[model samples]
Target: MDTCYLCGGLLELLGTLGRLAHYRCIDCGMEHSAGIDNDPTPTKERTDNDTDMENQGTSDSNHD
Candidate 1:
């Protein structure tokens, strides 16, 4: 049985259309299409303003 590579839960077999099959992560709501490589997480681009969270220790967005 195929499981979600991301969430590690049982993958739901949507249906086979022609030569393609689809699957979805029940936990994370990530979708996988048959003919495409599955990227589980959103990729963040490095920016000049980007810094280590441990070093910065805070965000500009206020908690209040």
Candidate 2:
């Protein structure tokens, strides 16, 4: 049985095409592809506007 790298849950084999095997996590329901170097963890790139918004929110809360 294969385990999911992100959630460590049981992985179910959906199907295979050529040399690639697809899998789906039963616990998290996340789909994964075998024989590939794909990262499942999501990431967001922070911009200057995002930082400014966070600072504004912090200052607004302090004013009250």
Candidate 3:
């Protein structure tokens, strides 16, 4: 299962909205969304690199 970015907890799929897949952390209750193209499988393991890339993207978007 994919791990939560905030708390490293197991993430459960809440549902999908069009091409977006939504998840919620079981531990911290933090919500996350992934594009179906980016993540073909919701149960895929999340790596540290994935987290870093996501964080980088978020930071870059903040500059816009």
Top-TM-score structure, candidate number = 3
Tens digits of per-residue lDDT, candidate 2, 1-64, equal 6778878998887887776777888998778776544433322446899888887845444534
Q: After superposing candidate 2 on the true structure, give the runs of residues whose Cα lies further than 4 Å from its correct spot.
A: 36-64
Winner of 1 and 3 under TM-score: 3
Model 1 agreement with the true structure over 1-64: per-residue lDDT tens digits: 4666667876666666676667676776566556334433222444556756445866587767
Model 1 residue 43 distance off true place after TM-score fit, in angstroms: 14
In model 3, the runs with Cα more than 4 Å from the true position are: 39-64
TM-score ranking, best first: 3, 2, 1
What C-alpha lDDT, on a 0 to 100 scale, does residue 17 get in candidate 2? 77
Q: Rank the candidates by lDDT, best first.
A: 3, 2, 1
Per-residue lDDT value at 34 in model 3: 87
Decoy 1 TM-score against native: 0.45
Using lDDT as the measure, which candidate wins? 3
lDDT of 2 at 34: 69
* Better TM-score candidate (2, 3): 3
